[model samples]
Target: MKLSFLVLAGAQLGGVLGLWPQPRSLQTGSSVLKLAPTFDIHVNVAHAPSDLEDAVSRTKGFLRNDKLGRLIVGRGASDSAAIQHARSLNTLQLSLVHGSVVKSITDEARLPLGTRSEEYTLYVPADGSSATITANSTLGLLRGLTTFEQLWYEYGGQVYTVEAPISITDSPAYPYRGLMLDTSRNFFPVSDIKRTLDAMSWVKMSEFHWHVTDSQSFPLRGARP
Candidate 1:
């Protein structure tokens, strides 16, 4: 069984940016900041967790457009889970600091049954001086990160920008969220499965039930003794 889960928090923005799955509480912003080729992201912490570091690394690549080189994350903090305090110096720089890091993304999935922690809060100041995202686990962080990415848009056919002065605090309304996919009746390739997973993540859906085998066919490859 392939099971995935997601919980949404509330969101508030300063302006109307119309986000998917609509954050529980969102306040849209007025100003918009363009993502220029020179835009850079810097992760600042004392001892960073591997997972947080990895997230930042991936974020660098995801934010990359055109020939913009890969971004680098600075080092700080060591705790697996800690609150981060950061400030952006200018429009060209973005800073992030977390209180603690989650060692693995799967860690949230391992919580005891009925766990309701997949929540996160994000703040993008109107001044654009800095942005902040806070969560109890990396799962929420990931969700917030996805939301942050969704905020960016391509303008003039080449530039990307996000509405400024946005704030969102999101959490799931239900304790258990899941999606079911039957692979037995209709074959789905690995890429398709991944796409489904991505879509689920975007909507903060937590559960992914993969029906790999059914009465129609049993194609699952079991471990050989």
Candidate 2:
């Protein structure tokens, strides 16, 4: 027998500010930012910047609209490492030249978040020349990227546009934000679980509680057994 269940999640973006769970702080600007059919992404690499590189790569992969253009990655300033190792670091900078197809993104510092740190600050300059997303850890970067992606809307059913010129600084109010899923009672397939995870990521959810064993059945197989 095949059983299907629907899960409903709600998110809200209000006038340059997101209403879903609400960020710590948000400021809206006057101008609207838009992306061209194609654009360039430049990643500044200095030392072993694997984490930042991976962040950019994953972000690019998420945005598979084909509207993205050339990807240029190079070595940044020598002091880049020093900046990344700072303690009180929580800032991101994003710059986009209006009428230009080039966008520059930089993370200020990658501070260590003990256990859970969803804290991030995003800035979209009113001048429209740039924007930034700052966070303490790579996890914060992931959250910021998810929020940034939500800013873009599809046009004519093909193109993606970001109505920007806004600033947002967000951090989770609660450290433990997650959802619980019961597989024993209903037996959800792997694909279904993945789909749920995708949705959770979009909303900056950090946990997935799987209740696999119950009175109904123990579908989970043990590798040792």
Candidate 3:
């Protein structure tokens, strides 16, 4: 809102508020304000509430604070519906990449039936100065929160600041995108599946193909063989 400069630690500091500069865009004085009719925001991967927060925060840094907004969080197919439901309440706009939508904000913590621990994409509104979030698993939620912190930390607190009409175009390249494991070939952990799913989402894969039939019976417990 205001701009001033002071010399401390042999470096000149200014009271300018702006998005942290990145390779993608210019860094103007932090005090710049954005005027917009629509906003289009994108978050590649979000599986926890914290990730939603960070994405919202980064988005705010780039645009002028709006009274209403939309948020889209995309996750792997295995993500629980409960996580996505939790994300809907606070967002000015809410949508899941491939996640389900919940009917009410009051029930944001409901996960999908028979989903695994790390499979979820939660979104929350960035309308208020801050949002309130609750997850079925406290630890899982914490991990999501940490993700937002990391995005800010890694980018030195520069948020995604821009003033553009809200429009987004996203679609998967394949009909079925998924995580595949050969249990008979080798035993892979859940984390590996999470990682693979994340990669698939980036490439717009919406289906999962599990080739569990091998010479030996590794017998993966989650999927029916």
Candidate 4:
């Protein structure tokens, strides 16, 4: 039914065809939706994180600037008229609410330091208006965005398209879902670690255990890693 790669929402994100780790509950529909070039991202709650905007920007930028998939555009053209014509687009509203972020951490929205709740619900309306990602916290929102990225694919020499009228309810089965790397036995560069962390975030991993210090080696000693 398809011919080419979907030009990827981003290297670190996933979509409908292959939502990483798979949500607990998911239901899709027959209708399809198109993401306009200037689609907006809006949050419901007040005082959201700075990272939220940046993350959304990076996530959506992949669709706008196509590097390889330009069959629709002529060889020397700077932009795609098909994409630009739909500048009047609807916003992808993010309805983010606060839940019990963590049982241990008391104060509200200790975003950077503590383990926050990561449960989220994604809704794409059948009528194709105000597609929303509802979540209990910013952490949950991050997870929802990752799943949203995977839903889109390049359709008929075009990009930023997805099957709409879908709903998903997702949460980690275990709070301590984690991945540990035994770096004590081997040395890893910062670039390698960054890529690994991105991959971890894509799968919604709760923790990463960098086993840096063992009896024999201390690669991350005496300096910040």
lDDT of 2 by residue, 43-102 (tens): 322232465566566665555463432122422133234323322211234322223222
> In model 4, which residue pairs have backbone atoms overlapping below 3 Å?
14-150, 15-150, 15-151, 16-150, 16-151
What TM-score, over all chains together, does every model reach?
Answer: 0.70, 0.63, 0.31, 0.71
Query: Can you tell me which runs of candidate 3 are displaced by over 4 Å?
Result: 1-92, 95-154, 161-166, 220-225
Error of 4 at 128 (Å): 2.8
For model 1, what is the alpha-carbon lDDT of residue 37? Answer: 45
TM-score of 4: 0.71
Q: Whole-model lDDT for model 3 versus the true structure? A: 0.32
* Highest-scoring model, TM-score: 4
- Model 3, 1-225: lDDT tens digits are 123333352133222122121112111222111222343343333443554555455444533432222132432122233223221212233233345432221123233323323222232222222222233333233223322222211111112221111111111123233556555667678798787765553333334567766666746568678
Candidate 1 residue lDDT tens string, 1-225: 223222222232224443666788887654545443445545443344576567656555655542321122322122112112112223322222344544355777667657746687887675546567777666667777767766654323233333466778888777667899998899889999999997887667878888888787998898999
- What are the per-residue Cα lDDT tens digits for candidate 4 across 1-225? 132344443322333545678788877764445665557788665665667776678667745553333233453143344344422236778765655232211222244434467778988775547878887766677788888776655544445443357789998877766889888898788899899988887787777888988889876647568
Evaluate all candidate structures by whole-model CA lDDT and list the values in order: 0.58, 0.52, 0.32, 0.64
